[model samples]
Target: MTSLWQHARRPATRDDDSWSVAGNVYYGTGRPIDGMERPFSPEFEAKVRHAYKSNGPVFALMTVRQMLFSEARFQFRQMRNGRPGELFGTADLALLETPWPGGTTGNLLSRMIQFADLEGSAYVTNYNPGRLKMLRPDWVTIITGSEEEPSLASEAIDSELLGYMYDPPTGSEPWFLLPEQVAHFAPIPDPEFQFRGMSWITPVIREIVGDTAATRHKLKFFENGATPQVVVSLDPSVTPEKVKKFQALMDSDHRGVDTAYKTLYLGGGADVTVVGKDLHQLDFKATQGAGETRLAAAAGVPSVVVGFSEGLAGSSLNAGNYSSSRRRLADGTMRPLWREAAGSLAQIVNVPAGADLWYDDRDIAWLREDQHDAAEIQGLQSRTIRTLVDAGYEPETVVAAVAAEDYSLLKHSGLYSVQLQKPGTGSGAPSPTPPTTDPEVP
Candidate 1:
């Protein structure tokens, strides 16, 4: 097997401004110039990072990264007849466990999930032995091309994934890496682009903006003396200077939380009119909680899992509902992510023949509730194998058939068990007791 560093050493040659060799294909020759460098939008990535740090709901959703990083380990799994078989470890597994000098698999996974979630894609490259580097998603560009000169009309179908280009913002020359040397993980693909991925946050950007605005509004309410807007009306006879003086006094004495509930001494002919509603009157929790739920939905995590207000209220915290929510997140979201991560990282790992890199989630505490279901399924499969073996089927074929859930794979052994055979029909059986009865009659 070729090492990742060995593949990285063979950088694609750039022929000219218009054409370049990326992996096995000439990237710029037939591809559109505008589509040549496909980089994740930096502005969007920045916005996601900001929201993750500043917003409550987004931050809560990001906590899923910890669970993902902690729950699973990578190993080689044998594939037999389209079914996963035994899982085994090898020297290559060490690379994932200790990707760098001090990095563990969790560290690598956390970074992968963070970048993938925030930027819609993550790239992992191995330029040195026993060390892996994660590229900034927005800085790395995907390079695609065609094996043959594609026509303008057939480019979409003829185009193939070539590799990636890592162009840093420090004005250094870009590094070109073959596809096998870099693991490109984009769990969510962008519908607009052929190879680009789309961020889950993209769909709920409006919701995030609304939620942020609501938070700011709450802060401002407290800043303004924790009171609703008040319009001070002075009589027509009052002088402008007096009105200005009164406004200044109010701002100085009672305009902030520090001065909240202070006595207000209004001059004669002054009328105070309250405008707008307080936080309670606005039902702040319901408003912000709805947006939080929407954001969680987009994150593929149930609101209950994130401890959002909407999820915590009512019966969402009930044992059954909570378990279901956990199951949804584990099975529907994290499992798929782990699978994709394994497949992508397979590019850098040395996998044995008939074996694929897979995540071992059996030890994940988050999914321990699923153990009962797994055991039940195993019991059923064991019983099926036993029945099939006793019914004249080959033992090996019976096991394979039961495992694959395809009884057609079972082969007959042309023999039957004692229970399934006719009485006294075997070669070892006594000749029918008729001889003894005939001797007695004679």
Candidate 2:
């Protein structure tokens, strides 16, 4: 098949020694006839990483995602008459299993999810046939081109995806890869851009900031004698120098968790009035929990699944509710991500003629309940197949009908079973002794 890049003009190349310098030169230089480069913001990605590392809820949510996503292994699945058939393993899967030397499928998957969550996209390239390399999403640029002359105004409609450019931080010459050579996984689409993704965290950035601020407040509360602020009044006769010395002494002696609840000595004419509310009055739990829930919601993970305060409190921890939450994360979030990842990675892998790349979650412990549910569903389908076959439907068609849940696919044979047939018409019944006796008697 002729590739899109083959028809488009080649992008102008610069002999600049530094990739950053070339990038600066090309920045905002209107769309080239060859291709337009779309780069992710490194600053935003850095902030995402900082949140992942510093925020407890964000960390937990992403960790849960990575842990579950990595459990699914890649396989080949063929479509049977527009429906998915059984998944079969292939040698091509080996590339994913051991993407790089000493790197397991889990490592590769973790990196992919981490990058995707952080930067809103993940890029993988098999520039070297047998080995797979993950490109830093922020460092990689998507190259789009069009057959028509490039115009800034209509670039969105006219351009077609050409390939990718990987610019390393070492100021080395960037490597340009064909679309087929790179696998781009962007689960969430960016609203403002074409052919780009937006991070789940983007929507909940305010929540994250709020949560971090709340955490800082809690730490400060503890650091400040673990008590609320108090207003101190002194008599007019007291010297300013004396007040300053007394204030310094109070702070030095009473500040921090270790000195909390210590006895306070007040001299004559000194009065301390309690002013600020304590942690209980402030309701820190509710404050932070609300933000955590919002973050979890954005991540498409139930707060319960990540053990957030909101999820663990009240009825959320009930067995049924917890189970539902787990299912939501597994089915709603992880499965879709895995599906997208498989499809993206397929671009670089040699897929079988009749098969597409897919993920197999049968072995994942987190989805054991799903496996049980599947078994029950299979059993029901088996009963349906048996009933249809016994009703004289073609066995193949019966199986297909049961599998697809479309009874219209069933085809009946020209014969019926004994129960379905009228009294003596059934083949199972003894035929009337027609011949000799009847003739003789007649």
**Best TM-score goes to which candidate?**
1
Candidate 2's TM-score: 0.85
Model 2 agreement with the true structure over 273-384: per-residue lDDT tens digits: 9999999999999999899889989999999888888888899989899999988988799989999999899999889987899998878988888777899988988888
Question: Which residue window of length 10 is worst by lDDT in model 2?
Answer: 19-28
Q: What do the candidate models score in CA lDDT, each in turn?
A: 0.76, 0.78
Q: Could you tell me which 10 consecutive residues in candidate 1 have the lowest summed lDDT?
A: 19-28
> Which residue pairs overlap in candidate 1's backbone?
none
Clashes by residue pair, model 2: 225-256
| RMSD list, candidates in order | 7.7, 6.4
Clashes of each: 0, 1
Model 1: lDDT equals 0.76
lDDT of 2 at 138: 68
In model 2, state the lDDT of residue 134: 92
